[model samples]
Target: MRRQDRRVHTYLLTLFFEVLISYIFNQLFYCETSKAALTSMPYQCQELILYGSVFADNLQDLERRLTGLCDPGSTEFHEHDLSFSLRTGTDPDVTIRLRRRFNVDSFTSHQWQFRYIGGPEPDQKCPVIVRKVIDSIAYSHLMMDFVKTLGLRMDYEYIAKGTVWTNGRMKVVISQIQRTEKAGHYDQSNLKRFADSYLVEISACLPDSAEYSATAKQLRDFADQLLPLVEMEKVDYWRK
Candidate 1:
């Protein structure tokens, strides 16, 4: 009986030690993972805007495409939660936006817009805008890739404005305004706006984080994609 008691005690001690070791390892692993997540800076675009022009003739087709994409039942829904609104009167407009959440790491957003320019003039410009938001810097490239698919031209001027803070920087606001064209179907110099031509605007927030360098490079690349469409202008302001 004494020997059996000793054996049972030994077994109990072994099990206790094993459980204690497991608990310690689990705590260490959890701490390490939490620390890594906290230390690793997530790069993301807080906000982004892209401007372009669409013609009246193309309105129906554009609307149809947007509707199809926003439809939850559609296979091409692109895995985004969609919401939309339409306003009509003298100047009609439509807005379609998509959003997705990804904890603290990242989120995705896409917006499509069409607004009519109403005036007495024979020619008026109807503008369409595309805006997006990404919560992480890692998504910068992916977002730009999607932008390229829109066939947007950079025939515009871009400006960025922001302020710096100790804990975090202010959101970067980038605007790409369409320049006045001397001659074209969408010439603005003549004080005439055509539906076929569009103005472009892009805005984004630069997150201040450990990944700032990589994020900046990605942003530059994103802007470069539209360089071919932009007119000569001083963009030094953005660097500062």
Candidate 2:
């Protein structure tokens, strides 16, 4: 009788432990799956912009290099065209436009841009625009990298006006200009007076279905790539 009781007790203890282990494993698996789903949620980005500037002296040289890249005979050959338009009014605006259409392996013609601006001078202070319809989040990174590589080569100066991420409806914009001095040494007055001072604006439109967490992470990743090329403290706008 004593032997039978001991056997029964051992069996019950083993069953209890087995049940506990199964419960813990299930809980862990559930938590991990939930986390993965949250992280991997699809974020379709419709557009992206990585803005920067260079010294006025380098604008002509930069234009030449960019034109060469767009030239059909050049190794970086891309189908492109150039157009110009001027606004005559109280405030005259002159825009030199360079439109590049990209058609490469696995990339569609939809991926193109009209990078145009007035001048590189501080007094001109015109923002160079890179408007595009991005194919994917990863492609956005590559596009920015291509721009950054070219800009760096041309000794271009990159200023951050702001980094924007949107889905045509909801939007998230991280701007460093917001935190700068409002009325002191680094105030808008002082920044505007600086010859090299120019604003950089990067705007993008994502799919409405994109998860905020994933989209934010992608934006942060994009920002990370610019860290070495931009002021560390200024790029910290995303963190805030």
Clashing pairs in 2: none
TM-score of each: 0.19, 0.21
Top candidate (lDDT): 2
Clashes of 1: 14
| Residue 224, candidate 1: C-alpha displacement in angstroms | 2.0
Candidate 1 residue-wise lDDT, 1-240, digit = tens: 477775666455434433422343234334435533322122223232233333445434533443342323212111122233222222222222323331222323322121111111121121111122222111121333432343322222211111111112211211212222442222223322223433323333543232233433444444344444432221221111
Query: Among all windows of ten consecutive residues in candidate 2, which has the lowest summed lDDT?
Result: 132-141
Q: Give Cα-based local distance difference scores for all models.
A: 0.29, 0.33
Candidate 1's C-alpha runs over 4 A off are: 1-197, 208-211, 231-240
Residue-level lDDT tens digits of model 2 in 98-146: 3333233433332333232322122112122112221211112133344
**What lDDT is reached at residue 125 by model 2?**
22
